[model samples]
Target: MMRRSLTATPGPARLRISLAAQQNGCASGATEVTSARAAIATAQAGLTAAAAADTAARTRYLAATQAVAGARKTMLRVQRQRPYRSARVAHAKSAVAIVTKTMITRRAQSGKATAALTAARTGLSIATTRLAGATSRWKTTCAAVKVTQQKLTGTAPTAELTARAAAISRDVVTQVRATFTTADATTVYGITVHRSVAFAFQRMIDDAKADGIVLSGGGFRTRQRQIELRKINGCPDISTAPASSCRVPTAIPGRSLHEIGLAVDITSGGKTLTAKSAGFAWLKAHADEYGFANLPSEPWHWSITGS
Candidate 1:
């Protein structure tokens, strides 16, 4: 909590991250539901067309059946007259056979259309289910948005917390200053800093104070101070040690931003800012406006170049 030095690590990042993720999920869910509804519409249209085709086919089939029946009666009457071989009887028989075939064809067409209609109805049902699933998922993802939003906006930190942060910053300033003579460095608000960065940092701190957050840190380490940190933090060869080799992750002497007075290890409530600190949340949201950049691996570390 360089901002929440007393609170917890990883809180602020998660709050903002959760806030963004939930909002995106809500949008995706809405889109899915919209697509499902479109599918339902298409299915309904297909069903309607199929039903109309089935009706037309049934009508034609019925007409064909009636014609076939009349033909049969005429053929029977001609047969009773005792001339089965007559051209009239032959013609009547042929007419009946033709109508029977037409009737059967229409029946098949009607059956096929009915089957299509059934499939369309099934498709519509599936689409509706999809929409329901999408809606449910969206609601689930958005559930956490309210709480995380409040976290990012920040609640007023307790007075005790504020005092602790200021105290820690003061102690750190004294210790860091002990590493080198302060006579040659430019000091602003008690933290040694590069001249180019002093103005922006002051404005940023003032703005933070206006918004109820106290910002403090140590800066401007001499090259010798860098070597001391590496040794104290446990790097085998302090001067040549890699940043990660030290127990506290010290940068090699010449490479450190502190030596040039461009970086500060920030503090709030006397603790390093954790993701959950109200102080941290404020900085996370607004530090960039004043041209400060943070090192991802070190929440307390921020510099003009963000190493």
Candidate 2:
């Protein structure tokens, strides 16, 4: 009689536990997605700020260059006037000497010659001072131009920082793509990508289609499939051959982003994708907004991360 209970308590408990686990998984996915979005936003903001700073520095540098040019012109003009002023000073001093030596009837004439010599010397001194000021201004402006150019291009430390930021952005995108699950796989434009990326790909495809482009591709290969392709493509054994010798630049099994369901090899109406194609051009112009980037070596290859 004790074993006659019809209710299954453990079954309901197990069902509840499973449901909770599923909910937690969904929550974790959402959190990851949100984090990825935040990272993208931060990267975009940094790029914008860098661009603005570069523009400002360029403007300042151009102004400094013009200032230097003006200073040089002023210095040249002063230099030209300096020789004339010196000649006038010499001539005036000779006049004074001549007046003093020849006992001139008018002492007023001697006095006038002496005053003219003093004025000429003063004018030469003023011209020399102006030239020196212009030279100093030109040097200062040249220094300013160097500093601004360094800021615009970046010094060693600034260059390293910029490189690190770029690496971080690429890493974040890679991490997001790596988190994709089997359930996240979806068909897009005759290809497959993670559900998270599928919408973006679809948008890109639709937009391209509107512009008279028809795109197609396959994506999301398994490790075994990748291995098979590698063998068929006459890929050199990665363990023995240098990676550079591979005919197809396919990654080793289990090592490809394509295996993670975030990459695709796209084509336009069965034609090979190339830099010249409209579809490729469209993707180049707009794919980054959708969190996709083209693999530089392979025009047909596009992924969440450039790697």
Candidate 3:
């Protein structure tokens, strides 16, 4: 299967493509797991055959022992007669030892057959377990496939789709002049973040402080601020250039997570967190616990999502 990665920031079409690719991989895995059913059937057949052979060997051993007993009794009865030296009597005496040896040999054969049967049973058990695991994985992945399908499916009319997208944008980006309105903002450790994330952000900071790792950061930039930062940072395009393309790695207007009040450029001792910073290490270890994820490209940039 071909593996495709999602773009740094996926648009709606890219999102659909990534999900469809995932669905294809999932369906392929499902197909591969179904082959385990054939292995299970094969193992069961081997067990059945081994069991039948072991049963036959055991029955043969039992019959051989019974034969030896009958021969011994016949030989004893013949020896009690005056003409005990007869050929028939001698043969009966010989038959007892011969049948006894045969019984011993059959016993050894039965033991070997039983060992083979045990091995077969173990093989069946292993195959059963393998099948079960594969089946479970198949179910889980196929369920994931269903989710990807849901993600890829575009059932809404084009007009409704555009309208809904616009509506969502309006809900998320309520303004462009300044930071989020008071109703949407909450203060956390001197930084204003989305109200939904404020509690977690504060808790993370308090916990970090307890660990002797001071946490401070900037958050919640307005679209105007984003544009200003872009110009200051020398982004190629005012609105479309990637953050990574800017001279100072600044996001373009409307593209900055800061505009959403979900991202923060964390600092320690009033300096941005770096790879060597203790505060960065602490966040790496514990930030996810508070629903914060770091963007790998910028160690100091953290948000509800890593992007």
Candidate 4:
């Protein structure tokens, strides 16, 4: 046998069978590789989607943290302002109280000072009134004495006139002494006086008695009798010792005229006499010649010569 033909030629049917088997195997392998590639792509797409979701969540957390921090800062600022506002209110209240207290104290002091000033003014007014009245009487008696003295200038004292004057003094004293018998008159009236003033009172009483002018009630038989005499003689209104003494207490012991002499408070022709007197007015015109003068209040009071 020829060396056997190792390369055998396939008939047409066997070749067809070989080609069919080869095509079937190739199609199966292609299908498996495509399925694996598709699976890989799907896994990659899933990983990308999960990463994107994680990034979005992180961004939102950062924004929320910033908002919280902003809110905390605003709260701290409000807290800081609270104490300052309270302090301001307290200071305002204290200032108002201090001003109110000061105003009240000043008002009280002003009221007290005003009251004291008013009282001082009242005392001064009373003292002024007393001094003015005393000065008015003194001028009147002096005028009457001057006129009386002029009338007597050319004529000397007649024995009858001297007798009459002496009797007048005696009569006046007799009447006045009876009224003065009470304890108060003796204590206040005769406690202090000049010796000459006492002599004048005695002489006047003696003179009035001699003239038959009896002074039953302290140099007045009646007020009406004295008034008639005053009208006839053109005599002025007369006040007596209680109204006419010097208000000031005597500086010298027993020096006041009112204390010893009967105070003859008289005016001339219904008016006070001047220091210069008209003629024939014994209490005014001849008072000095007979040792008499105008007492401070009682214008008609006289003293003895050289008293």
Whichever of 1 and 3 has more lDDT, that candidate is 3
**Highest TM-score among the candidates is held by which one?**
1
Ten contiguous residues with the weakest lDDT in model 1: 1-10
- Tens-digit lDDT string for candidate 3 (1-307): 0011212334545655755565556556656667777888888999999999999999999999899889899998888878557887878878998999999999999999999999999998988898888778766765664465444334335455444444443444445324545478777768988886675587578668878999998999788988988888888999788889988788767667787787899999999989889999999987764556678888999876565
Worst 10 residues of 3 by lDDT: 1-10
199-253: candidate 4 lDDT, tens digit per residue: 3343333344444432211221234444344444443333322222323212122
The per-residue C-alpha lDDT of model 3 at residue 264 equals: 93
Output the TM-score of candidate 1.
0.47
lDDT tens readout by residue for model 1, 1-307: 2233233336766665666576567557767878888888988888888888888888888888898888899889988885356888888889889988988898898888888878888988888888788878866764554455446446435575456544654454445445544444687788888665575577567657767888888888878888888889999887676888788889987777788676888887678887788777887887754446678888888865567
**Superposed model 4: Cα runs more than 4 Å off:** 1-92, 108-158, 168-307
From the highest lDDT down, the ranking of the candidates is 3, 1, 2, 4
lDDT of 1 at 194: 66
In model 3, the runs with Cα more than 4 Å from the true position are 1-21, 86-89, 152-307
Position 122, candidate 3: lDDT: 96
> Could you estimate the TM-score for every candidate?
0.47, 0.43, 0.44, 0.26
Prediction-by-prediction clash tally: 16, 0, 0, 43
